[model samples]
Target chain A: MPERIMPGGVMSGVIEAVISLLLVAGGIFVFIGSLGMAHLRDFYMRLHGPTKATTLGIGCMLIASMMYFWSVDGKPDIQELLITLFLFITAPVSAHLLAKSGLHLRLKHADKTQGKPVELRPEEVGDKPVPHPDKGHG
Target chain B: MLSIALYITLALVVMALLMNLYRLTIGPSLPDRVLALDTMYVNSIALIVLLGLWLNSKTYFESALLIAMLGFISTVAVCKYILRGDIIE
Candidate 1:
């Protein structure tokens, strides 16, 4: 545990302002993501939002946190960095997996969603493409 | 100043969680539900990090890290099960 540094100056105020800005921006992005998830008409379109939340939204908040701790503790906290990196890596992978599964399940897309996957066969997906619960629907 | 911003962000995140819950409850497809869950956990991590900042403690970072790892693994596992019928093959 590093000794807390109580830096009382204009820099402190500036850092706080920055952190506040980051927090508000991150919050807004997160809200927007969820809003899209809730209101978007199709599964594929819905998937578009959360990836933003996971990357930019969480990324902003994490940076603000790192800045917060560094100013207060006088040492850069690496845990937030770890989370940021892990999210940047895993968010895309999970999104890919979700999209793949969606395609496997034949999830319906909005009519406007373009560049649909063509000729995706079930056997081509996995060793055995499991019969999904929503097998009958589009 | 910091506290005010934290509160507003807190409210936004909590609302985000609620929206996620709504999607989880009524998502038309399995992947949508899974995506909702994934987003839920990520939002929770943000909430946890914010809590740590508000309380001025460092302990929450470990929990946030753990949640990130677990969330990603669970999502991948569920997706694998959905695709292949078996989790580990």
Candidate 2:
């Protein structure tokens, strides 16, 4: 009963309230990000959706989880910390690779897109193609 | 009070996953499908972590971590295959 009574004060109530708000905020961000991904007109434009908002959304959720564990168990959950780090690192890399593949395929561009990359013919080269730097290993 | 919040968060995250599924199925192009799949996995990870919070169980922690790792690897591998026509040199 003493342990239960210990966590029922005004300050703890405030902390729990904040955690609730964060959970809602994070979920909302995730919902919006997915909405953009599904509704966007072009693949390239869709790439922007999950990369930014979703990453932030998950970050907020993890932070709330971390705090919750700390408050309940009296120990910080370091795994959430590691997960946050991994997520931030990977979200961009995946987005970049997806976009890169789309560009490599020369997928259709939106009507107003500018600065589309032009494929240069072999004869249009400014100079001879340089040999691979590591080809001597052969 | 906290449980109610957890329930709402769970509902929203599931809705996001549903959107991802919609994109994956209705995709016009292969890369678009791949992108949807990638987002789906990430959303699942968030869902799993949220479940862990609600259950207050440490068990789901490792699973969430593993999903994060595996999801990233699979996404990158698939993207590479699309980009280069092969996953390895």
Model number with the top TM-score: 1
* True A-B contacts kept by model 2: 0.74
lDDT of 1 by residue, A23-43 (tens): 999998999999999988999
TM-score of model 1 relative to the true fold?
0.88
lDDT of 1 at B23: 99
- Compute the lDDT of residue A68 as modeled in candidate 2: 77
Taking the tens digit of each residue's C-alpha lDDT, what string does model 2 give over A61-94?
A: 9898887777777767799999999999999999
lDDT of 2 by residue, B1-89 (tens): 67788889999999999999999999988878988888888788889888787666778888888989999999999987876667765
Q: Clashing residue pairs, candidate 1?
A: none
Question: Which of the numbered candidates is closest to the native, going by highest DockQ?
Answer: 1
In angstroms, how far off is A43's CA in candidate 1? 0.4
Sum up the clashes in candidate 2. Answer: 0
